[model samples]
Target: MATITSAGAGSGIDLESVISASVAAKKTQLQQPITTKKTNTQITLTGVGQLKSAISTFNTTLAKLSTAGAFNKRAINITQDSDDPILKISSNTDASNGQYNVTVNKLATTSKVEGTFASSTSSLITEDGTLTITAGDGNEFTVDVKKGDTLQQIRKRINNASDNFGLTANIVNTSDGKAKLVIDSGVTGAGNDLKISGSTTELKMFEADTSSATPVTGSSMSRTQQSTNAEIDVDGNILTSDTNTFKDKVQGLDITVLRVSDKDSDGNLKSNKVDITTDKSAIKTLVQEFVSAYNTLIDKSTELGKRNTIVGGESQDDGGALAGDSMPRSIRTLMANTVMEPNSEMTGINSIFQLGIKMDNDGKLSVDTDKFDDALDDNYEQVVALFSGENGVAGKLQTSLKEYTKTGGLISQRQDQLNSDLRDLSSREATAADQLEKYEANLRAQYGSLDTLLAQMQSSASYLSLLSTS
Candidate 1:
């Protein structure tokens, strides 16, 4: 057997030291302290996520409560002013003489006027005296027709010569059984303008020589077709309309009635031109919503900052050690400072502190209710000016919060980094555990082999000594 020196026997590397070193390296690389913090971070993250969700819900609710529907709970009412407002007339003449103009004006309040005219009523002319009536054989009749033609013979003659006259004749039975030949104009205004022409005898028909005769000049008169009552309540008083001006009906407010029939390119109704003025009640409701939201935010912040006792020991931490931290303090400070800070963009909302909202040492807010009410009463417009338009406190706060919590925000970036660290640590720990198992197995095998070799050498030396003594 070859002489096996300690150098040749096995590796000089300490297996325990190698395992311990691998473990330490993994621990350092993995940042193992994070394991202890995982529970704390999870609790804090859950509480923060819940708080963020609550705030989002509160914002949505506040927006809904601040709408027009919330402020104005009354229904809009409409009514027609008068009964006999519309008129209908039919006349018979040439195209130039058939047209007529109609003008509508606001009678009592304002002298605003609108006008339109009929295109034409020339079709009202029903008949002409010069009728070249041809018989069925296509021969013209040489009949001596007087000015006063009985209604019966005219009907018969027109019916017999239907092809030439192009007229429909019918003897309508009256209620008293008296028969009359009625001539209905095929065109709308044709029958309304009956004239006699081409015969001297037909001229007498224009004048009512007999009491029973119908005269030309006194044949038609204009008549009114009245509209029904349309009424609705405006504020507390009843408003009526025949042809109501939209402006007069709504009182001080101007509402445009968009006709859905005429749609724009985007399939939306074209807005009618109108100006609207805000009411006092509307302004009041807006102020109330702002106040309510402000109060709620203050209360929630205070609740989040309060310390509580678990069992007999009082905790110095707000809410709880796991749940509470700097987040609530930061949010409260941000809110207070934002309201107090002066900016060119938000001139009126420069200082909510001036509006009687104040903070305490514990980072909680409170409103001086009486002072706020007095401010609203004394200068309501100033309150509206502070929070109504584009440069309002609520608008600024919304913008700031959106920027802070969005995907690429500071908090979001920090959370991402922490997640990455956690994953890397877990992976390294798993790798270290695998390496430790392999190193331990190799050390056991080497030590077992060395012990077996020492036992064999001792047995051989004892047998040789016994042989030498013999």
Candidate 2:
């Protein structure tokens, strides 16, 4: 029947409502299923991407503890018997756990000397000449004294010279109406003493001779301190250093001597006990981190695969986004297998089980702290091997996880298929819409002709009735 858009249809039927209802039914029949399919496909695709991202995050934990260097963290503790403040110590991984008694005998001293002049502002040098300052270490600098340069002026010249090695000059005005020009070597060591000599008689009074144990005769300056090597007795073995700092003197220990230890009643040097021990806490923390990361992967994956649930006594029909997906299940299985396969070859730690990390039926991990501590205490290296070695848990997971996570892997392929389904559904929805449009058009066209036919039949009957009456 035709739909009567105008009010003149004799059929007396509201065909416009009929045509609209028919079109609505066709659209529902043709397009609803495709729309549902697209929605489900998008959910599945999103679920797969989440799974891949979770796996990638877990891989970071694997990468962190995958090296021997990560196991090289050191914990050094020093305990001293005396509070002499003699040594500041540090050690690296190469240091062994042992006790050493170090008695600092003498700290290295710098050579210093002083030359007295007439007054604080006197022209110490009356004529020009060269004053050569040399260190026993072969560093030297020469200064030219003008005819009337004050003692303070000469001090500035000596200090300002770039090649002055490690020498420092200061002028101290004494209470006896005379000025003292004090020059000291900045370097410390037995043979690095300072020697100041002049080329002319006028500058000779400013000369310093600290080269020998006693200042040489005719040297106008008085020796204040002598350069000496730093001496230490480590467990009855004497060790001497040019400077105060001794690096690797006892394997990985670096020591800087600050002062000589005080002697006891019998003139015996006091000793400071150096304590070195392994830090077992770092390894334990690392193991705990591994447990947490593995459990996270398990927990997230399990959540993704959850089935339908009942909410407020009403059954929520659909499950999680990744429900019933075989690829995620297979991915979980692959990881579970890698976490246990091909046991480690390291001594004592044959597997992760020995290190107190265990997996449950749900693929979640938990640690036994007492057992873990015992393992770390007994065999630290083996514990490192079980987690980070060539055939270890992390190692195997790293190799197996790539099969699903890499470009064109199982996860990628599944996502690709889901996306293709979505694209296909879009095309199907468009086709269904086009078909519904044509069906509505056909109904409207056919129903309009029926209305016209019905109106003509009514008119013929009315004309027939009038003729009979006449």
Candidate 3:
């Protein structure tokens, strides 16, 4: 008789465990959404993008705070005194003669003259015979006088040479039918003393007739120095300097420096302040940028809350409010509270809301243009304090945001934890798979041996039954 006895199946090879393990691994991969290899890259990119956007918003706000018409502290302007008239000779006019002198009480430490002059004779005459004339001394005079020049020719010569000398020369005909040559010194100083001593006598008519038997008594022209630079009060302080660097003399102002004499291109003896007006357009642009950035953040938060992206969703797709949100509710809460809160350290600035900026229904920032302008007009310092003062909104926001994104911050710590978890999970999955595969192979061998034994027993039983029946 053939009997069937139970041989242990040895737990049936637990195929379900292998399948469950595979399913669990797939589920784990899906649940994590980001792998160890890609998590850093995605998070880094997202964090950088958010940081850049925040910086852009901050910059926009800062730009709005800067007033366009604020006077450039470096600017300066130099204007000549209107009350005190400056003496300038008309064209075609010359000094009483080729020899004329002027005197003034106040003297400019640095003085210069540039003009042209002509004389009847070519003989060079120094303004002060005692003072040696040197090139570029502002005192050297060039006399363009040709030989055999007439009285009228002498007048023309002085006019022609007016550029070389600061003085002018002209011949005035008296009622006695005699012409007297006159010279007028263009500048006032001891250096203005004119002397004519050369081989040419044509210019002698303009000199003092000291040799006449009867000494002609007239106001003997003498040279005197005078202050040529204008004085001005700057920042409640009295400062003196050359006209060229007058702008530098001022404490704070932007000025265009100009030369006093037309001959010297390098000489800057005057300065003109440039006109600066408030740039309303720039302010408007800044406001728009801020609004746009704020709106973008709000929109991004909304999208993240609705969708199950790594950055926030609910149920299977619901990453939960915090799960997939790019701009988390916590961050929004921080931003809102920081911008709205008042700081005890800041005296005038209480809140950004005081500056006429408010959030709309869409959770985007908006500015009341007129009210904002009024607030700015009222107290710009208070506005600055509100956003940028000690422990202020902007400062707090920056600190909080940086804490979340900076190295060793929340994001970095989370990433490190995730990476470690992934490593452990990967090792566990590999070990489970290896153990399962070995178990399956051993079960297959056992099943093959049992099948061989069962087949032999069946064959022997069948043969024995047939022989007995026969």
Candidate that would win on lDDT: 2
* Residue 237's lDDT in candidate 3: 43
lDDT of 3 by residue, 123-180 (tens): 4343322211122236455455455455566456555653545555565566665555
The stretch of ten residues in a row with the least summed lDDT in candidate 3 is 91-100
Give the alpha carbon lDDT tens digit for every residue of 1-470 in model 2: 44445433567767777778888898889888888888888988998899999888888888777754455555755454445467888766566678889899989888999877787586767778888988785789998778888988888889998788868999888898888889888878888878888888777677776766565456668789888889898999999888998888888788889878867899988888877776678767787788898889887888788778889988787676898777667777887877776463555457778778788888888888999889888887777677775466786787788777889987889888888888888889889988997898788777777777777888898899999999
TM-score of each: 0.41, 0.61, 0.44
Quote the lDDT for 71 in model 3.
14
Give RMSD (Å) of candidate 1 vs. truth.
Answer: 20.1
Compute the lDDT for candidate 2.
Answer: 0.79
Number of the top-ranking candidate, with TM-score as the measure: 2
Model 3 root-mean-square deviation:
18.6
- Deviation of model 3 at 412, angstroms: 2.1
Each model's C-alpha lDDT?
0.43, 0.79, 0.45
Look at candidate 2 and tell me the lDDT of residue 180: 81
Q: What is the C-alpha RMSD of each candidate to the true structure, in Å?
A: 20.1, 9.2, 18.6
Go through the candidates in order and give the clash count of each.
Answer: 20, 4, 53
Instruction: Judge candidate 2 at residue 466 and give its lDDT.
Output: 98
